[model samples]
Every structure is written in structure tokens, then in C-alpha cells.
Target: MHRLELDGITKQYPAVRANDGVSLRVKPGEIHAVLGENGAGKSTLMKVIYGAVQPDAGTIRWNGSPVTVRSPAEARALGISMVYQHFSLFDTLTAAENVWLGLDKAMKLPEVTRRITEVAHTYGLDVDPQRPVHTLSVGERQRVEIVRALLTDPQLLILDEPTSVLTPQAVDKLFVTLRQLAERGTSILYISHKLDEIRSLCHHCTVLRGGKVTGEVDPTQESNASLSRLMIGAEPPQLQHGTRPAGDVVLAVKGLSLAREDQFGVDLKDIGFDVRAGEIVGVAGVSGNGQQELMAALSGEDTRSPAGSIRLFGRDIAHHGARKRRHEGLHFVPEERLGRGAVPTLSLAQNTLLTRTEAVSRAGWIPSGRVTALADTIIRRFNVKAGGPGAAAKSLSGGNLQKFIVGREIDADPKLLVVSQPTWGVDVGAAALIRGELLKLRDAGCALLVVSEELDELFEISDRLIVIAQGRVSPSIPVAEATIEKIGEWMSGLWAPRETA
Candidate 1:
């Protein structure tokens, strides 16, 4: 009997038909992949399976028995556990407290905390049970979600973009854990746009396009190109990362040391780097290291750095706030999309005001018509899929929302752009689009500081690369001379002794 089966699942929304007559099947001990572009209905289908959303039409069978899973609690009772792309964690709650809410009420909080540690250690996931969700970085929060789901000991696990925020080393560790679970007869429904990962990790693959299944194949026998064709109907556009002589340094950090703001935060220690005009500088590291702290310091979110530590064009701007830096043509796209990059409840037009003020009058009154026009231009330019300018930021899919946030910043045409995880959770096509745009910006003599965990992305777009580990920055290396092996080693703070310029 199949471990799980779905037939003719159809979900209709006012703006789009998210799922249309989609059928899927999974066997026990199988690792099945669901492949699609952004808004291709992969996440929506997963939600239907997890009971987070009710399908307008579908028949679900569990172990040869038809059943209706009305809620997440009911899904968990039926041995189905899901780790969403956008985490379902509460910011005010500690890791253990959030995990405990999804588990049996009879279990004590201390017991849940202990189990979290055990699971984390066993799977090589670094998680702090006592850390509040607000204090955790995107990558660290990913670990907490994984550990929580593993504790459920479910028969079926639905992971949506689980490795999006993880470092290369962390991804390897997670694969081992998933393989072990599959061997123990747990079925996994993995949803990701990463073709290489699906080809290597999944046994079977289901490709989705336009809210329907396009093909099903044994992923082990498929190539990345074949998978891309299945998902997006064509190959992703190749990025042109041609290099030119760099101009004057646009952003320079020297001896940037800052104490952690909270007990759970990582302290920045003597971090230094330089980003020059007409170039892209990529920062690679494991999450929870100092990337968060470094970004805060550079973006002027934290003005606690010592004088002469940070300079833009040789000017002391270490004490400048985000707005002051923005006035000097420095714009940033934060790693956290919904809460930081864009507000959740605000319309797309309103969210534009977070980093833009061109539509505001001298009296500080925002002109709605101008704001909507700007938002519309960004949407059309970046090809963001949404319900026009009035759609709430949270209403769009993760990838679509990412495109909008990135588009919002790129539209500003800043002299220096600091973007963290520019294409996190986005589709292959969208990733290529965003990377190409960044390259265009670089070629136009705009300096860019890109922070991402994806080594492939860094190698594709960056001119120079640096690694961060344990709150310290490594010496810079040209992208032409950098190798995955060397960069991976550097990510662990294993670089040879050298002074960073």
C-alpha cells in the first residue's frame, strides 16, 4: 500500500487556481521530490497535505485508507509533520516553547528541551533550545524547525525548501539525517527548486507547472538540465559575470568589533573588508556566525561600532543610522524577507515606503498615486506575481515576495547595494533574473556586497569572495582563484593566517 496518495487535488483562489487536478503518490521509505517554479503550486499542495489549507477538490489516502485531515493537529495525529518554507514559529517564544506547542500537551517543557538537544546533536543541527525566535538568524531558525519536526517521529515528513538557508556543510548533514529517516520507513515529500539537490537526494520526482503535475521520473537517472526543463519548461538563462577593473572603494570596514546585543547573539570581532565600484563582494558563512552582526554594522542598523571602524568613500559613517546611509546612496535588502525586507500586513505599495521616499511630498505626505505607480513599475520590471499593488506582502508566495523585495531595492539604483540572500526560496528562473540584475548593477559601476550561504550563487556572481566564521572575517580571494573546497574550508574558519586588507 502507498504510504500517501492524492488524487485530483484542486484549490481555487480569487486571483489564481493554485492547484489544478494534481495527483501524487508516495511509498514508505521513499524520498519523493516535488519540483516547480515560484507560484507553481508546490507549497500550496504541501499545505493541503499538512492540513494547513483545505483543497477545494481532492481525495487523500493514507496507507490505503481514505481520511480527511481538517487541521494541523489532526495531521500530526495521523503522523504527518511539516516544516514550512516560512517558519510557523512565534517570535516571542523560545525554541523549546515553540516546539512544545506542536507536541503532546502531556509532555513537560523540560523534556521537550532535552529532546531538542538530542535531536540537534544527532543530526548535526546547531540549535539553542532557550533562544527566542527573534534572536535566531534565518539559518538558525531553520535548524529549530527541523529538530522540532524530527521529534514528532512521524511516518510522513513534508519539508518545504528546508535547505534554503543552510550552509553547504549543514546541507550535507541534513541529507544524511533524511536518508536515515527514509531507511527507517519514514516517507519524505521534499519541495525545492534546486535541481542538483533533487537529482542527488530524492528517489522519485514530480514536476509541477501551472498548478498541475507535468511529469514523474526517477530523479537518480536525471540530469540537472533535464530537471530544469521539467520544472520551468526551458533552461535558466546563463548569468554574465564578466569582470572589469574595480574603481575606488565604495564601502570599507576596519576593525569593526561589537559586543553582542543579547545573550544569544554572536559578537563581531575585528571584521574588515572592502567593496569597490564595478564589483561584487560575496560573503559566505554558516548561519549564526557573524553575518547577521556584520550586516547590521554595515547597513547602519547597529551604530555601536567604534569611530574610524567603518567608512564609505573615506567618510566616517560608523555612527550613521540606516536612513543617513540611504541618503548617501547605500541601500540594503535584509535576509529576513517578510518582517525586515517588507512588512507583512502592508500592501505592496505601502511596503515600498520602507526603503523608498520618492513618492513623499516635502511635508512628509505620501502620494498614493505615485507610490502605486512606483510599486507597479517594480512589479512589472521584476515580473513579480501578485494581486496588483494592493496585495498584502504576506499574501504572495515566498519566491514572489522575494522578487518584489529585491526589485524594490534594485529599482532605487543606489550606488552601493548590500543584499543578503538575494534569492532565498526563489525559483531557478527568478534566481537567474535577480543575479543578472545584480551583475548589471555591478557593470554600471555600482558596488554590491552580497551575503549568501549558497556557494554556487557566490561563484556565479561575485568578483571577490570572503568567508565569515565565529564572528571573524577571512582574507579576500578573487573569485577566479577560489574553489568550492577552499571556500568550504574557510567557512569553518580554517583559513591560513593572513592579514585582511
Candidate 2:
């Protein structure tokens, strides 16, 4: 019997049809994949099912009976729970506290903490119950979300880009947990842009495009290319590798060490690396293993480092602020796109003025025309599908916002660029385009430092790679000489320097 069913789901927004006559069903013990590009209606449809959004027209059947899921509480009460792509966590609250607030049950703080620990242990999603949400790394925060969803013991669970922030080991653990859940008669609605993951984990898939269902197939029976064709109507262009040699070192970090700012945050040890002009250096690591700390030091978000630790063209810049660094032709694209990268409440046009002051008046006022023109250029050039330049940053889908931010920085023609998770939550087409753009920037003599969890992405665009483990960095090695096994081993802090060898 179908565990959940939707028919004729139509959600109409003022600027777009988020979901247009979409329909799908899930069976008990089924691990169903909802496959689509960004803004392709998969999220909207999932929201409709979970009661986060109300469809203008649709019939939702629960266990063979029609029902109206009026709110998240109602959905949860009906044995449904969801984990969002962008976390909805309270920065001020601890992990246990956040999870406690989500549930309808009343439990003592200690009891809730104990339950959290139990769930984390059971599911292999390690989380600290006492760590404040803001203090947690992106991957840890993701674990909080997953653990919370699992705690509900819902018959039907909805996971949106669930593994985006997790390490390979953590992802494997999650897959095992998901498989176990499926075997226990709990159905899963998995939403992700990782096609390989879907093929491996999902038994069935529903493809969507432009707010409509396009096809249904058993992903295990289909190839990646076939799935891409179904979802995007064309094969994504492969990013071409470069043949250029690296130039003089544009960015160098030597003996970079800093105490953890937050009580639960990771401390940077004697970290070191270098990025040369005309080459992309990829930093590989588990999420919490000092990437955030390192990004902060590099981007001038946290400048508590020694003056000589970070050098931009042989000049100490640890004292410079983020804007000052940007002024020096150093640009950064943060991993957290919503708040850190783009203000949600601001219009796209206004956000353009955030980094590019040229979009403002001579007196520093936001010039509407110039801002709009700049935003439009970025949108059009990046192939970002959004309402318009005047649309709020929160209005566009996650991928569109990412595209705009990346395009904004790339358009500036920076001498050095530091980007973290450049393709998180982005579709295959957008990822390919973005990766291609990064390579193109490198060819233009831009020194690029990339920090990513996807090993394939690192191999694709990087000329050299360094593994960061437990706040310490391994020696940089040429990409051609790097192996997944070597990088994977070094991710645990086991690496030897070439000079030492």
C-alpha cells in the first residue's frame, strides 16, 4: 500500500510556478528519490507534503485516505518529519535544546540530552548536546538536523540535501542508517543533487523540471547520463582541465595557529599552505577539521592570527578586515550562502551593492539603477533562474543565490579568490558551469584556493591538493600525483612532507 500520495499538486508563486500539477507516491519501506535541478519543484512538492507549504490544488492521501496536512505539527503527528537543505536551527540554542523544541513531547533537559546521545550513537551521527548551534561546524549542524529528524521515528522521513556537509565516512554511516530505516518499514523521501548517491541509495526516483514531473524510473536500472538527460534534457558539459603551470605564490599561510573562538569550536594548529597564481589549490578535509577556522583566517573574517601568517603577494594581511582584503583584490565566497554570503531580506539589486560599492551613489547611497544593472548582469551571465534583480535574496532558490554570489566575486576579477564548498546544493548543470568558471578564472591568472568535501570536484579543477586534518595541513602535492587513497589517509592527519621524504 502507498504510505503517502500526492496528486495534481499545484503551487503558484507570483514570479513562478514552484510546483505545477506535480504528483508522486511512496510505498512502505521504500527509499524514494526526488531528483531534480535547483528550483525544479522538488523542494516545493516536498514542502507541500510536509505541510511547510500549502498547495493551491492537490490531494494528499495518507495510508489510502485523503488528509490535509495544515502544519508541520500536523505532519509530524501523522508520522511525517523533514530535514531541510538549509538548517532552521536557532544559533543561540544548544543541539539538544533545538531538538527538544521541535518535538511536541515535554521532557526534562537531562532526559532530552540523554535521548540525543542515544540517537547519535545509534545512527552514527556524532553530535555534542551542549554545543551551541552557532559553535557547531556545518557538518555537525547537519548531524543535529538529521538526528532530530531520526528522533521522531516517523514512518515517512523527508531529507533535503542531507549529505551535503558530511564527510565520506559520515555519509557512509548515514547510508547505512537510511538502509536500516527502510528495512524497518519506514519510507524515505530523499532529495539531493548527488546523482551517484541517488543511484546507489534510492530504489526509485521521480524526476522534475520547471515545476512539473518529467519521468519516473528505478535509478539502479539507469545510468548517470540517462538520469541527467531526464532531469535536465541535455548532458552537462564536462569541465575541461588546464595545462598551465603555476606562477609566483599569491597566497601563503605558514604556522597559522589560533585558539578556538567558541568553547566548542576547533582550534587551528600549525597550519600551512600556499596558492600560486594561475593554479587552483584544493583543500580537502572533514567539515569540522579547521576548514571554518582556516577560511575565517584567510578571508579576514577572523583575523586573530600572527601578522605574517597570511601573506597576499608577500605582504602580511592578517591585520586586514574582510572588506579591506577585498579591496586588495582578494575575494572570498563563504560556504554558508544565506546569511554569510547574502542577506535574505535584501533585494538582489541591493545585495549587489554589498560587495561592489561601485553599485552605489558617489556619497555611498545605494544607487537603484546601478545596483539593478549589476545584479542583472550577474544573474544573466551566471544563468541564474530567478524572478528578477528586484527579487529578494530569500526569494530565489538556494542554487540561484549561490550562482549570484559566485558570479559577483568572479566578475570582480580578483587577484586571489578563496571559495569554500563552491558547489554545495547546486545542480549538475550549475556545478559544471561554476567549476568551469573557476578553471577559466585560474587560466586568467587568478590564484584560487578551493575547500571542498567532494573529492571528485577537487580532482577535476585543482592543480594541487592539501589535506587538512585536526586543524593541521598536509604538504601540498600535485593533483596528478594525488590518489583518493592518499588523500583519504591524509584526511586523518597522516602525511609526510616531500622535503622530509
**Shift in Å, residue 226, candidate 1:** 2.0
Off by over 4 Å in 2: 361-366, 496-501
The 0-to-1 C-alpha lDDT of every candidate, in the order given, reads 0.92, 0.89
lDDT of 1 by residue, 212-272 (tens): 9999999999988888888889988988878699999999999999999999999998988
Which pairs clash (backbone N, Cα, C closer than 3 Å) in model 2?
none
lDDT of 2 by residue, 391-438 (tens): 899998999899999999999899999999999889999999999999
Best by TM-score: 1
Q: What is the lDDT of residue 16 in candidate 2?
A: 91
How many collisions between residues are there in candidate 1? 0
How does model 2 fare in lDDT? 0.89
